[model samples]
Target: MTQTTPTTPVPPGALDGTGESSKGEATDNRARSRAAGPGRLLAIVLTGQLMAVLDVFIVNVAAPTLRADLHASGSGLQLVVAGYTISYAVLLITGARLGALIGHRQAFLAGLTVFTAASLACGLAPGTGALIAFRFIQGAGAAVMLPQVLSLIQRTFTGASRAQALGAYSAVLASGAAAGQVLGGVLVQADLFGTGWRPVFLVNVPIGLVLLILGPRWLGGAEERPESRAGGGAAGRSGALDLAGLLLLAAAVLLFTVPMVLGQEWGWPLWGWVMLGLSAVLAAVFAVYEARLAGRGGAPLISPRVAGAPGMPLAIARIVLAMAANAGFLFVMTLHVQGALGYGALRAGWTFAPTAVAFGLVGLNWRRIPARWQPVTVPSGFLLAAVSFAGVGLALRDGSDGGPWLFAALVGVGTGLSFAYSPVLTRTLATIRPQDAADASGVLVTSAQLGMLTGVAVFGAIFLGHGPGVDASADALWATCLALAGAALCGAIVGLVIRVGHLR
Candidate 1:
């Protein structure tokens, strides 16, 4: 009998001279690829986030130039700013759903692309109407992009990694806002590309281009679900797109915001009142529709359950009120310095730099504050902000020259304290389900935007109605600051309630 040696078949690329080396090299490549993947995605997403946040403030310094160039009136100027914010707020929920349905990465890229194009259109806008319309579209795009950032970070990372990523995200958000103001000032001052105020919008083009190009490669596709992988459920979740709900919400916001913004300018016209009535009706209808959907187990545009959560609505209300006060303070300060005090735009922009610097410094050490101290810090910060506002009021009353510096420093300190707990709020909300997180964030942003719009309108109305004389302006500003202080007092009360209720 022949001795038969059984030859075992080696696996593909197993141990042939270079085969093991090749396998090891392949493994190394994959490990490196995976390791680099999330970081790359984060960078791209943060860039997009930065762009979105930047747009919010980038136009502030350029507002005067834009107004002059486009022949826009005060109302038109408000539209230019408020139109974007209003549209952005209305579309946020829809955008989030769209991202979930179509795909986050695809949606993010598409939104970025649209936003970039709209930025160009805004730069080239031939008239005020064109600029306003384009800004609305740009805002729509931003609405789509911003939510996915949170979604992406949440879905991608987990555990401590997720916390760290979120912290970074929050920091980027603050930095982007601060940078927008500074960069807008610089660009307007420098007259880069000779585009004048247009460069503020145009600058987004290159940054956006970089994001669009790199995004797909870095962001990967949406996470594959277990059910999706098993092919046993809908590929993406199944729920109607809620177009009716969306339209109603849009109508409601427009009816409410348009009238609020234009009412004072148009002398509280019949049309404004009509729109206000219509807005109320639309809001009621929206509520009914949402309730119906909820009862049917269909996903409502917003989750009523989350919205109705204990303390959440109150928390949001306080946030809105506080933001409204902040907006009024900013508006009055801007007008006082540039319009009344005859300071140049550059000088005015520089005036706020101290506040920004202080905010950044405090924000850097935010983590050092104990968790238990967050409740105290938030209210204390508000109190400080109120005091700062009062200081400005006093400075105005005293007719002190170069007084904005002291007030600005106080503002910086107050802002730093005010934001100290934002991270804590974010983490607390994150513990909720993903959809809840989305709903909560949407609600918070909406409240903040509305507060800002309302603040400007209310404060501006008071100022203009009384006339913009030095004394009148000063009085209006002081009253506005006092109102904000009242709001901070309210927030403090709420904080106490939260602490007490939690104890109970």
Candidate 2:
């Protein structure tokens, strides 16, 4: 919550440190002046932020519809939904580095342009394969644009203004997520001029275009690259890209993700198991290589300092698990309500609104609690999530709606997850020094994306792996919910360890 102070105000021409510095600085200052107020800057940042976050969940509501229209296989439908996350998670660190290298404002706008174009492509896709490809591109755009948001806030605002801006960031996250569900449903049900599921994606086009126009007008260039001023290590290799690290990380995720996603449709083939096993080995290799890179004074893809900060890994793990379980629960419920129960898309979408609202409420207000009690909330939240997940499974087991109990369980799960995630993330970032903010942000964001990706792939597999039949699907969901509950318990255990170490 403390303001990052490394962003000393740049006198005109200081940012470029070049022969034509005056022109660049004048241009930068003029842009900054136009969007001078924190309100204007945050408006631009949060709108892009909302669009990026909303895309992740919006597809969930449209999944069943996509399947019907595209004639997508079960795995294909999952691909349509998850392919964006795959590329997004894998490329996020690279995207952060890219933003740092080529000016944050430019990166954001370029990325937004790519995202908008890809959304249009997704809307117009002729087949499932094409749609899946476009989704990956869309995710890439998000990865590029999103990391700059916090950087911009850190640069443009100070003190109380910065804190409020950060609050707005959090609010947008909650609003975007909840709004995505309801909006996706409404758009689908209305069929938007009979466009069917396409509108869920097409909706981004106009908004993206508006942001694209406003982005250049509103956003100012600061020390978008924290390394330039904060620390010496990152400065040493300002232009370096970690090719080896990118390869290893991508391979590891792909090995694990591809198998988990396709194994169900592929009948749990031997190759899938082999790939899954290999992923662990690659992950270990990635870790070792990154430590060596950082130790050699190179800019590693992920900073070990940020990741290995006191009590940081444990705190981050709790969030990663919490995210996985949270995403998994949403995916499974969508499957149940839309696929098995035959609920309309709008009705099914409404079912998730309570969870999103509850999560937003808890996340936004947890700070009001006494500081002393905050540590326990992490573990306690996970424990609550476990119970809520169990209740949801029990409620959903019979084909009929679990009625009020279902909604209540959803609300409880949302609250539990908000407590588990939001506080831990704030504390986790607090562990990093200002110079390392971008890397720290990259580590946390990449991990969160990875968690969501894992949840969708693994939980989707667990739910759909069972042979066909409503009874079979329902039984699979119960088992998946139990599995998710176990994951939350693990998160709780991790949180307790963090507390025992006095790492709050």
Candidate 3:
């Protein structure tokens, strides 16, 4: 009865819960090897991100062609652009959460598949309504995919490697955004595959296909941390989902953004104000709910705890303000180029090329820029941009038709440096805890989207209220420049705050 075979007991900490460290020295070695090796997966992810960002500006250059072919009204055209943006912005928080719940790699692949299919639908849509619908879907896919790219890099790499990856990500963003207008112009003008403006959407299909094929082989499996698997069983999956929070967030964004996009077109009707009021109420309610969830030790959609972090909210505010000013500048400049200068779409697109080139070049050197210099860069960018805007106003006032090239070049330099701010915000955020990273990213993106929405609305109203006039060109340009200068001043103030805070 006492003949029990002696068994060797496993030592404490032998199994490091999630099995992340259980692979021992060999696993660490492998991770280091992968980190040092050329990352095919990273490249694929960046390409997808580049495509998503590019789509934001690509259609701007093709708007006229789309209007003619689809017989879309001015509102319809705005919807084509706004639809994607609003959808993407709304889903960003939810997407990040979902990616965390299911593996990031799986989420990325799933999003790519959806986006690729939606692109096909967009290209094939017979009318404006259909196109707008598909664009919304495409944007939703983009929301899901974009977050995973950042998360995967964060998970896969460490230290200097992480910084390098982020820098590369930044470079892709700058280059893709700049290239969009040029590529769209070329594609639209060429009438590729006899598809009119359809090729712009269709071009994504091949790119998506390549990503789908290579993703499985290159992305590797999800590396679950010990804490992630602590609860075990269905609890692990349930912890990931956060369904109620996601629904509330989605509702909050829709209620807010819909009015902003549609209110001007509808003459700011009673319904629109009602929606806005509802949105504010819903936002408040959502905030309370998230707080309660956090208190209960449950994961909220955005995680209220992170919002309370020092510098996070301030960073978000700065991002929103800067983006608003930038968007307004673009809106006014577009009109100035096309209406006042009488330049065609292709020529107007080309005018912004120098900015793109400069941005790409500067973005590559972002890694070397110190964190302390980040605040400085923002103000400097705004100052340069303000000067460029002033130059435009001066030229318009002087009735000089031919010197836009020089003014645009100055704007280009400003825009190039403008590329640094977001990355700077990202870098500042790297100090945050891992669990809060997704929320930070979401906040950063949401602020930028809101800024864009506000910018378009405010600047569009200013431009339209003044009415179209050749003689009024100088007045319009001056008014826009003053507004931009005001924005720059705000950015400067924020930079000062950052500097002072650091001093403390």
Candidate 4:
């Protein structure tokens, strides 16, 4: 059998291949620069991601303090949280487009500047309204920067290094979720500088400043190669920003997101249902409109050919389902442990330590696992997660204390590696052309954000509606567990189907 070479040209020094010496020498120099500075580059980008993700869960621990300190009413408090999420979710795709239009490095720097400045504003806000507004700005800033993380990784790294970079992204996400809560609890308890919950927002200021100063120099010109800047490889080459598509898509996302964020808080009001229904209709319209634009040889927000790829739909579904389960379960568990079980914020946060540890370890070594095992690994991991979730529910019901939760957390760690993200992401993007990387990454992240929001809303509703009882918390935990189990089952089926059909 003859060996087949990759059609996508490997960047110079990307592989030890037969080639001209002068070109190889130039590529080698570029590769050396990348190797020497990649750590710093990765640091700046990953830190941005960590901060963005941290903001998502960090505020939960500070909510009561914010309410009291800012004189925030119940609705005001909801807005404080929801504002960040809504803006982040709605503008993520737009942000990705902006990165493609200008450059990832420029976009990232701009975003970081906005985020850091907004963070400072958040820390200093004297009222709930101001805080909410600042948080929204912060979210928009995060949206503008987060997509660049993946884009830069795609551009700057290749082969195993790229795989490792992706693994680190997954690890940071897992740790940030748990660490945000833990750090928030600790900071609130410390009340350092007599600032109460202000430290949480203020903390990003210094880090952001450091990154802002060093990011430009370290990231350098790697992100602005002529091909990337020209058309972003493939997707960006099409046409001007699809303003109409952007508007419709943004409206649809906002409509869908607002209800998910606020419906549980407002007891699922009629207007919320209306918004949800309208969102679906708008989504359909957006799809039709995008398809028309693509057919007309115009730039569409989502390329039909890309979205129609064999495993793309299932992969997206897996993302939404998995994120929904993870987000919803975490939300309910936080309430159950703190409210019903009388656990303090710090204690509640520590319960997830096992998950972070497991996730970190697996992420660090994910490349050791062969690519072919992905299909089997993912479904197996989901099944394992289902078992752990069931154990958590059972533990809650039996009043078996913390031991069971720890075991469950540990067992659930595999899911973070194989189920929560890495495998599915690798598979989904495996066949995508490099030019479309930004669009594809944006789609993936947006689906994840929506899944998380929906999980919080749908599962929050279930937990909130539980009537007073001796085991009300347990009942809620069980319900959340069942939902997670169902999600895991769906994910497993998708994986198995893909394997059986040889779709990958």
Candidate 5:
């Protein structure tokens, strides 16, 4: 062989396929050292998560108080709940894309700051109109903060640490709603030095402040991947946010949500149906627009490819139906027990304690589960929940006995917890590349939020449409519980399909 000019040798592994990834991991380790330790980072993120979840559930408890204190109309109260959820859901994709452009840590701080300030405004709001407006803004803040949680966890940790962190996150997700119900009752009952329901919002003030001040120091810059930067990837510097797509998506969601929120109060007016029809058209338009954009190699608010992946559509559908029914179950049960059974707020709160406990016990230990077995957990869990819910319906039908009802609720919650901690998220987004994880997280969360909105609107409409009475309330509870069982059945089917498909 002819002698070649001497050249510097590349270090071993330097030019290997994994070299870049190894370098990235090293960089992340260095950055983590400069920032907060894993424990502190976990605390900061989990606290943010708890606040968001608490706000969603706590408001249900505060509905009656809102109506009484602010002289809110039925539709207005619905708006107070729906407004926050709608805004939160609508803006999530934009929020995730934003975190990529700026930095997740920065976005998280900005969101927390805004959320804290808005909570203060909500506490001080003098009228129903003002409260609704503030709640929307608060929700917008939540949209920004929530996506950062998953993104940061992925970026900051690895291996066993990642597993542990995710387990805690899931536990909080499982328990947050039930915990909120109980906490909301205690605060409302205490009245917090005559603040009435205001303290529910006010309590976030101190907690949020501490997070805001230290968050920047504790959380460092996001670990951005080079390929991810070009699209909806981690810390991607996408040319620009697809504002047109965002607007279209927002319009579609608003169309669907507004009718659901206002239809009952307006006596199921013709216009509401028209809006629902329009929502379908707009949703179709959004889908088409996203496809065309993706075809052109452009960034869409939600990546069309990811949304259309194998299991994603099914996952979204399952989440919407199951979560909607779950939300409706909480609402109708609260109304029936407090309204018809004459149970105090505290008593009503205690009704869900077993669910909360079960969720905590199972969810915190979710990581101990082996990967191979995790796939079957979701369907099994849902089946158990379905049986428990049917039992609740049977109890309600048989004179609403306290012992049977509470026992069913306990078993339902525990069963719900057992399987709800499954890796549905990872399975659903299995086709999604690591670069697009944040975008997938955003889409997943948005679907869940919309599901909650659907639950409140459709179920609330049913409850209000029947007018007020012990009998009407009982009917509403029975209807809602049956619906929950049905929803769980649907979930079980979807889960089984996914699992069977995997076996192939």
Candidate 6:
């Protein structure tokens, strides 16, 4: 038997099953400290991410059932859906930073524990209010847990291994959204044990419990203090929480996301616009304050170095664009099929499966494209997505079902989006220093969450605002598709202008 100890360094790729470096031989020292190895580590982290992202869309299909059983108010029903989104968005930046202070593994487990418990509460709640409250806690837990997935990948993988890791990460991120709808619909429709919509929330309980058990072992000893390095100042390496910045971030994110979440539901109330404006002001103030705090040698909530990293601004802009377009496409398609075509939840949910499958396939395999053509992949993806969305709009012009062509179009859209985003995310993190990866992950996740909300609000409004008629709905969906295509085109132009991977 081989000797192993806390101080013993593991060989690169030793625990990855093949006993060979993936693509490139480069390895991170931090990763070499792994007790359970990178393969298990990646599995653990992605499992957490799957659980978090799955809940994001799972409740959409179950809402009506839940409302009827609980006799929920309109706003309460919205909260059941949007409550998770709001808390998840508002707390992301803080969650990202939490891993830096506590050990990443500890933070991850703590958050997972919270999420699992909240999910149980949500499943068993006696009233809509309790479910809503539990959903917020669940979202808060997700917000805390999700960022660590990105950060752990950044810190633990290098070279070709890192690329593949990010690919799988991208697959999970995109596929989980559609998967949520499908799973939710199946669970609700099946009504196993005659539990109505409870199973949708309860399904996570067992999964979460399993993950919590495996996390502490495979995630290394994040609860234990990180070992000190050669010199001094190991403590400084683990940053502290800046409560002021945390509060400001929470306030800004809440103010913005709440309005975007509820505005259309409330018929675009005036107070929503007021909140939007206030959000902008608060965000600006937060920026100025954080910058000042960083200048003073204090631990800023968002480190200036991470935010101002080379090519970061443009990279973030592309993320926002990609996510917003993706969200808008999904939102519009769901509404178009269900609201107009009058499909049941399960049927409507199945409509999204093709997109999810195509995205996963492309996400996992996109790297197989020849090196010579790799540079054009992102722009090309954007272009494909743009054309696909345009085609969808044209097909829907007459207010009739687009037939099998609709599924093919969805496949194209998903493939295009996978190309547009997964590589960009990989390239963006690759450019940042590993030490700053946590902070960078925070910025990225926050941007993506906000973009999703923005997409649904802006694009949903365009589809919804047109009023209730077959012709009107068809025209509105067409317009919405055009807008989505336009957004993709803009991203394509940006990708062409700035090669994210090549940014120095």
Q: Highest TM-score among the candidates is held by which one?
A: 6
TM-score of 1: 0.82
Number of clashes in model 2? 0
lDDT of 2 by residue, 422-452 (tens): 7666544443444455566667777776686
TM-score of each: 0.82, 0.85, 0.84, 0.89, 0.86, 0.90
Select the stronger candidate by lDDT from 2 and 6.
Answer: 6
Point out where model 5 deviates above 4 Å.
Answer: 1-34, 221-237, 308-310, 370-372, 399-401, 429-432, 461-468, 495-504
lDDT values of the candidates? 0.66, 0.73, 0.67, 0.74, 0.70, 0.79
lDDT tens digits, residue span 125-163, model 3: 999999999999999999998877776665555445555
lDDT (0-100) at residue 347 of candidate 3? 72
C-alpha lDDT of candidate 1 relative to the true structure: 0.66
4 or 5: which has the higher lDDT? 4
Q: Report the Cα RMSD per candidate.
A: 12.6, 6.7, 9.8, 4.7, 8.1, 7.0
TM-score of 5: 0.86
The per-candidate count of clashes, in order, stands at 0, 0, 0, 2, 1, 0
User: Alpha carbon lDDT of residue 30, candidate 4?
Assistant: 49
| Candidate 1: count of backbone clashes, pairs at least 3 residues apart or interchain | 0
Worst 10 residues of 1 by lDDT: 1-10
Better of 4 and 6 by TM-score: 6
lDDT (Cα, tens digit) per residue for candidate 4, span 375-400: 36666667777777776777777544
Residue 214 lDDT (model 4)? 88
Question: Model 4 scores what on Cα lDDT?
Answer: 0.74
Per-residue lDDT over 241-260 for candidate 5, one digit per residue giving the tens place of the 0 to 100 score: 77888888888878887776
